[model samples]
Target: MSPFYFGWLRWIMVYNSSIRYIDDSLFIDGIDLASIVRQVSTPTYIYSLKRVGENYRRIREAFAPLAAQIHFSVKANGNLAILRSLSRAGAGFDCVSAGEIDRCLRAGAPAQDIVFAGVGKTRAEIAFAVSAGIGWFNVENLAELHYINSSADDLGVDAVKVALRLNPQVTANTHPYMATGHGAAKFGLTADVIRDILTRQSDYPRLSIAGIHIHIGSQLGDTAATLAALDAALDLLAAHPRIRTINLGGGLPVAYRAHDAQPSLGDLVSELIPRLAGYDVLLEPGRSIVADAGLLVAELLYVKRQAGQVFYIIDASMAELIRPALYDAHHEVAPLRKTDREPVVAQVVGPVCESADVLARDRELPALQAGDHVALMTAGAYGMSMASNYNARPRPAEVVVSESGDNWRVSRRRETFDDLAQSDK
Candidate 1:
């Protein structure tokens, strides 16, 4: 294998073999990804209506028989266009921050359709949620319960709807940063402690117990893990009469690589729907519905050879998408130029000045060259939402293909250098 290869013939080969839909990658359609790289530059997020809609429809159809609702996790991808599209497709908002609530509202989602959640909400955020008449609050602690009650009293609003977030103390078996429901993650109130809350509800007058919410964790790769979490929550819910709505926090996993196996939402429903029987069900699905629906397209800037290893460095980096460095995550890569032969082992990295900035390690990838565009697949979830302006890098633009049509639209304008210093004196 050559240490470096970036010729026109090599480019054409990779382009032809990469995953294609209508001769375009899963997320790139109608709009020229190559042109976007030329005009707006790299490190951009591209969304596919076809792929996103498929995930949404699969979950909806799988859970349709049950009395359930899908609240798109705003923390996953807060793009207004993304939210609006999901909202239009019979989805509601699951917000952890007031900013997310505001984003949902701006996306034209009804206040009655948004559910507020998270551990640390400010007094101002509480008042904002109450004032906007958001559908429900997934309260984390007694202090929050009291604060919400006090805020509702001050606002002179009708009784506030709150769902006690109960922790089953079961391990979600995921990464620590993303796994929240385990013993001491500071997420939900313990299920036993929740028994006391039910006993003392009258102490908080302004708060009305509307439901029970429990989130096991995030990026949960196992369907059995989720079902186990659900059974635990149901056991807790069995004793509470006031609990009408049950929210199972979303951590459904999506396969970034083609061979990884993840259970369909129906598989989860098949096990859970039978258990719940007649209760109102709510799921806060952030990643699984959107992750595989997005792609981060960047052009190769240079190919470097060190010893026997090869490097395909791109214009995108941690400033544009941080999941790789932050979580040691893996995303499938494809060369824009298709090749006839199999792949070669190479390291794909970005221009970021850190050793951990590599996207893929010593992995087999199609030989790529300068001018050849590549995609980081399954980025629709934590990709752009977790992006930062670190190193003062300009963020990428997001283009969305229409669900009902074949045309694409720019959802977010690409960030520029001026954006970095615009607020500085």
Candidate 2:
């Protein structure tokens, strides 16, 4: 096969086949480049509602036999429209804070459909969650247990469903900063500690032990680490027959680069469903569900050549998307309009003051000039959620594209200078 065909096949193999080139310019679904640029403008996040639904159906079909409860992790995108889209499609939410729970509620998700997970839950946050009647609290420590119990007692509520997050000590082979299952990571409780708590379950009467939760880390491609963590949870459940649910926290990987070898959702479900035959299975998938469903479109400002390297600077910065600088993450950069010029190795950068603000290093792309539009691919997950007002750069707007790309709606408005300093004032 030719290189072009092989490359195309690789992308379709990992992500849903929604991206295509129209003439020379790239188009998402049935929408053309010029229309998106003219309508939404540049430096905006464009999400494909069709792609999100496709991903959701893919996972749902994979675990059809098991009826796994799929909770969309709010930390991935957290956009209200995106949350509402998933919620309307019959997906629950996996939240880590009161803020996230509020977002889910605003998105019209039922309180019973939300699961709260975090290493640290403040007393106020716990009280808020209790008042909201959230479904589950994946407790990480004894202190958190105390808080949940006390909060439930104060509200005069019945037993609050609790999932004990156990640290399996299984190491996921991803970035060290993203790993959460290792002994060094300050996430879940150790198995022995959880067992001791289980032994004294009567002490916290208002807290009901509903299940166990295990999350090794994010960006996990291989099944070994996740399966190992699940095995550890199953071992803990073997002695305790009362606990009926097992939550495999979200960390399914998405292909950022063409060469990424992340396993498919179908493969993961096939291997995992058999192991969780009798018990209830819950999956929290954030990145894999939405990462490829959106792209960040930015306007090219200038091109500079210095010391045998080319830098393509864009108006957007780390304040808008921080994955590249924060995690050294890879995001494919492509021109919005097709180009016939020869390809050149260039570094795509933002106008951030810090040196770590580079988006892509040593990327080969068609030669381009100023005013050209470029896109950062597979950025729907953490791109907007991690944005900040650093360097006083205003956050970009976001729009949701229809499945056919024929219609679009603005989900978030662009931030203004006044919006940035409003908190200070």
- Candidate 2 clash pair list: none
lDDT of 1 at 292: 75
Name the runs in model 2 displaced over 4 angstroms: 1-16, 259-262
Tens digits of per-residue lDDT for model 1 on 17-126? Answer: 11253343332544555655666567678787666667777777778888678898989999888888888887898998999999999989999889999899998999
User: Compared with the true structure, what per-residue lDDT tens digits does model 2 show for residues 1-425?
Assistant: 54444433333222346766667667777776557788768789989888888888887787787899999999999988889989999999999999999999999999999999998889999999999999999999889998888989999987899999999999998988889999989999999999999999998999898899998999985889999999999999899988889999989888887566545777778788788888898889999889999889998899999999999999877888899898999998878876657677799999989999898999777688999998898999999999998988889899888766577878898888999889994
lDDT of each: 0.78, 0.87
Error in Å for residue 204 of model 2? 1.2
For model 2, what is the alpha-carbon lDDT of residue 290?
94
lDDT comparing candidate 1 with the true structure: 0.78
Worst 10 residues of 1 by lDDT: 10-19
Candidate 2 Cα lDDT to native: 0.87
**Residue 149 lDDT in model 2?**
89
Residue 324 shift from truth in candidate 2, angstroms: 1.2
Best by TM-score: 2
